[model samples]
Target: MKAGVFYGTNFRIGQSSGGLPIIDNDDIPIALVQGNRDGVANPANAQETYAGIQDPPKAFITIPGANHYGITNEDNLIREPNRPTLEQDVAIETIARWSALFLRGTALKDKGAFDYVFNSGDALDPNVSVESVTKPIPEYTSVVSLLGLGVIGASSLLTNMQKLVKKST
Candidate 1:
């Protein structure tokens, strides 16, 4: 997450020439798929962040026995598997199913078809997910990513300085 915003929240849109005034609020309906293994934006804190959302109605689903990337097919990424059951495939399928229904409903205005999504406000699993709204929203911060940018920039500057020194020599 950058500047207190959640990870992957830094999105931008441009006009034909990529000029503004930029339109931020498109009032798009959203469906939140929270991995049980994903400590960030877990169901509970997700509900809180979602509650603060000014966009259209939304849906939040927490797939049990999974982590932040539970939707992926990486079996080895499982957190502490010896403890709770890790239903990885089920979580992925569940997310796909909910996304399809939610998007279809949003597009076709078929609220009745996706009414179950309204229950997104429900409590999160106490053991794995965040149970308190007061805490910051959990996110998968790419530590290497944040550091890589600076490292790369510094390397470029040093390389240029070396080239200039050799040229002058």
Candidate 2:
């Protein structure tokens, strides 16, 4: 999945300098993983950004008791001091699992991954709170489907063109 993943960051849209288009305008799925205790980027800003995205296949995941630096090895409170109640290892593992599941679900088009991220499996994680918009898609049952038909089709066309060029030469 060509998903845009944001971790404890904020972007200003519609500004003259360094502004971006509305998040919903993006075609790819978006996931924002925020720590509840983040001081660098306010959690409220994350909420606003998530609200701006008016499309399905989007996710807003919050890690409870985690600070802005919780995703990293240690929390640095030099600029924005916020204590994390969650342990570093625990937060990292939680983030890693969810991120992987999200990628597997959207990019690999795996039904189980989809179920975990967009469906009921997310509830198993007590430390995470997820709000998402998602729709059902057909299960991909083959290696070709896993690779995506568009990719394979393009590769085949390119190979055929190369063969024709070789024969001409």
Candidate 3:
């Protein structure tokens, strides 16, 4: 029995390369655990990946109210102390339960573990006041031009540095 866990924010490799690697048919009984509220690796990407897999025993568990960093017990422990601690025990228990049901050929439903996060209700309290929601057209255009110029400047600098190193060598 083999099992694989993939979080919604675990799209670093996926986004860097445009999309995630396709799952081979040989790799069966895979489990993908995603977060519904994830900003980085959106649920759509996970769904796409799940759809690409040709395996039969695949399960996609979308945890509601979880953000990019909220799914991990370590992240929750440090960032949110006031909330109930999402200890390692809970994570291990969830993983074990999922694995036993999915990979062990047990007669469990396709719906994987859907544990409610403790600090889901806590809203972010920013110290600074927010300005206008919309930016001026001219300002936005200027910002884009400045960013383009910065990129060009950085590229020129890198080219010059490489030339200098080559000359020295």
Candidate 4:
């Protein structure tokens, strides 16, 4: 099985002539797993990306009181006082449950299991309310992946041509 995880906020697109485009869309799947308190990939940015996707079977799992690096559960030698212990087990369990349902077509519906990690409001600031969820429009296609390959191919060809021209000179 193939699985991919992306942890970032900004996404940019370029024009066909290799110039950055102004009318770029921040399309993303609804099946994203994110941290509500993520500093790098903020929830607002994730929401913006979600707004641009035109597909279904999507979900955005937001973990509370979690940061970008904190989710991975790396070792902390200094042991800063009052630091909340990383809920590594919860993270692992959430990813596993969702992945099984999404990637493996698991039949068992465990709303409690998924909601525990995603719907909990405890991790967010008291001033923040759960953002209203929306489904992606069902008409959009993701050409970014194919376009990326094309860009790489064209770049390689250009480099080869430049080398040949230099050799002739």
TM-score of each: 0.46, 0.71, 0.42, 0.42
Q: Which digits, one per residue and each the tens of the lDDT, describe model 1 over residues 1-169?
A: 0011122111121112332232233565555556555543344555544555444555445556656555567544344232225676765666566556556556566666445344332342231222212213335566667688889999999999999999999
Q: What is the C-alpha lDDT of each candidate?
A: 0.48, 0.80, 0.49, 0.46
Q: Which candidate number has the best lDDT?
A: 2
Stretches > 4 Å off in candidate 4: 1-30, 75-86, 106-169
> 1-169, model 3: which lDDT tens digit per residue?
3445455534343454665666684744565665455566666776777766665455665544444554455444444333322344454344444435444432333233211111111122111111111112478889999999999999999999999999999
Rank candidates by lDDT, best first: 2, 3, 1, 4
Scored by lDDT, model 3 comes in at: 0.49
Model 3 TM-score (2 dp): 0.42
Q: List the residue pairs that clash in candidate 3.
A: none
Task: Write candidate 2's Cα lDDT for 52-139 as tens digits.
Answer: 7766688888999888887899889796588999999999888888888888887778889878888776588898999988855557
lDDT value, candidate 4, whole model: 0.46
User: Which candidate, 2 or 3, has the higher lDDT?
Assistant: 2
Quick one: how many clashes does candidate 2 have? Answer: 1
Model 4: per-residue Cα lDDT over 1-169, one tens digit each: 1322334242331212332223222332234555565555556666666454444334455555444544455523353222323365665454455445433321233555334323563253232223323343344345676677899999999999999999999
Q: Is candidate 1 or candidate 3 better by TM-score?
A: 1
Off by over 4 Å in 1: 1-24, 40-45, 76-84, 119-169
**Worst lDDT window (10 residues) for model 1?**
1-10
